[model samples]
Target: MADAASLPRPRRPVEMSGTNQSKRRTSRSWFSRPWASRPRTGGSWHAVAWIAVAACCLPLAGCKTWKKMTTSEKTLAEERTYGATADQRIDELAANAKKAKASSHADQVEFTQGLVKAMLDEHDPRVRCVILETAAEFETAAATAICKGALEDPDERVRMAGCTAWRKRGGAEAVELLAVRYRADPEIDVRLRALRELGDLGDREAVPVLATALEDSDPAVQYRAVGALKKVSGRDLGDDVNKWREWAADPDGSTAEWTIAEGFRQLF
Candidate 1:
């Protein structure tokens, strides 16, 4: 222990005179002043950000929403609160569908039912498109039913998706579905998409659909039909609709277009 007198004294805090304080405040900017000397605030700004984040009012339990939506639905579901948007719900559905392959039969059935419900209840054209696309992953009859219904959906966007879904579920049936869409859709855009998918099919059945599209009233439709014919028929008619129509009128009469791959395939 040291002697008391040998111990160093604690210094008192400095006090400034009114004139000195005024001079110090005037000399320095608000931000330049020592942090301790600045005025203290409770940070109302922090609360403002929090309030903004929580401002979105959530709906009642029975109200329509994409995520965990009510089972009893007649009209399209409405937009949801934060973290529960229609897009987010669709993404979640797609993700869960990926895992559903490992799930039990009951779970798969439940998931499919929920997804189909979402498809029927969703009013957003983009959301409906996603639902139609999601349905393509499952080979269930219910899923197929919704996808078929999309072709006749009031929204052309959904109808366009219906064309794509059928293309993914390819076969003679897919060709037939696309052909129907091309022949009957009121919207020209949907008809164009149908022709595009039909060409992608590369099936013999699509040739007739493409040929019929060549005679459509819309020149754009006819032009698109010519492009599809080039792929489905594997022959370039020089983009002339008339020449393609002539060939389509008698497809078996024309020679096969030669390609390196086709030659090799023929050899094998």
Candidate 2:
């Protein structure tokens, strides 16, 4: 009491007991525990798991939303929505050509023909083929013109379809168009189809072209020309190119004999 500074400061509040010290350590550990080391309740962890799952799925949902639509899908969507533009209408018709029939409404036919005419020069070959096919059903002057133009299509399948449609809508003009395609088309199958259609047309103007096809490098072409010649001219030269050439040289000479022979053969 005489020297207060040296009195040991009243034993520093009696220095905590061992049991109290353990209690103090436990209380501090509760407050200072790492967040990851803490135990979680079922409801809290379930909500956190769902949040993580939603976060992972968000990007996938965004990817689906950002994907570009396909051409057929776009066309179908346009079909379901009304007030389509002229180009869109044309695309719809072309895309649905397989399911569509020749429209019985004259006004509809005329309108579609006008649209098809406008799309004739489109870069897509599929569009051109569908247009030509639909046009053929109308039997209109514009259809004939479009079919004629299709004979020169860069695609062989389009050329074949055009030729078939032209033959179905036959006239002098159609026969003439087929004759040109038969003689000038670089594709052998197209030439053969043209020749066959010409024979089906039963036009005499195709004889000279058929005779030329007799000497084609492709034996199939040569044989097809033989069959077409037989149908058109009633001559059965039996695949002999030389004999066909001889007959072609003077086609007018043996008409009477050939016609009589054809009549007799038909009788049998």
Candidate 3:
């Protein structure tokens, strides 16, 4: 019944205002705060971030790997990678022994003895001498074996090394054996070496054998015997000096002969 002009306007839903839109945007940002924590803005930035993390942790991983390697693993790796020859291996072992820190002296002695035994058994005389030189470090039965074998070595240098080994481990039996050989050994050098070893042993029982050696055809043997007898029995062969001088001056004397004669003079 109302007039057309007076008719009521149609109602619509409430529209969002500018202030409401702003509030909605702020609320959305707050709700997604974690997503906004992106890395620096650059290409490959994500890859660099991951790499940085790995780099920081790589040393720790490497340390763990090193810890996992055992002593045996290290030894095998060295042998395989270093291409050690027989002599090289022996030298390596010797160097290792010197550097090793054993828990006890007995363990060190055992290790040294085993090393010497291995070298002496090597096919080469030079290697055997290397073992003989180190024999003083070992206090064991292996030294005894080295001495016995050295007595007959084809190489005089090797035999001399054996004499040194015997000196380091001299005993009554050891001196007696050398004394017997000093008077009877066919090689003048062997005879001289035996006398020197006996002197190092300093056994009283060796005196008689040394005295008998004075009659040997080799002046060097005779010279060594006189000095050795003097040491074992403290007796001076005063007039026998002339005999030693005559032998030493003999043109027929060899390097071994002169060396042995001189050693006697030095000892006496």
Which one is best on lDDT? 1
* Candidate number that wins on lDDT, 2 or 3: 2
List ranges where model 2 is wrong by over 4 Å.
9-52, 57-109, 115-118, 121-127, 255-268
Question: Any runs in candidate 3 off by more than 4 Å, and if so which?
Answer: 1-90, 99-113, 239-268
Against the unseen true structure, what C-alpha lDDT does each candidate score? 0.79, 0.73, 0.66
Give the candidates in order of TM-score, highest first: 1, 2, 3
RMSD of each: 16.5, 8.4, 14.9
Model 2 CA lDDT for position 179: 77
Error of 3 at 68 (Å): 34
Model 3 residue 91 CA deviation in Å: 3.7
Which pairs of residues collide in candidate 2? none
What TM-score should be assigned to candidate 1? 0.63
- Could you give candidate 1's per-residue lDDT for residues 86-130 as a string of tens digits? 766777777888887678877767777887788877877888888
TM-score leader = 1
Error of 2 at 6 (Å): 4.1
Cα displacement (Å) at residue 109, model 2: 6.5
Candidate 1: regions farther than 4 A off: 1-83, 104-106, 255-268
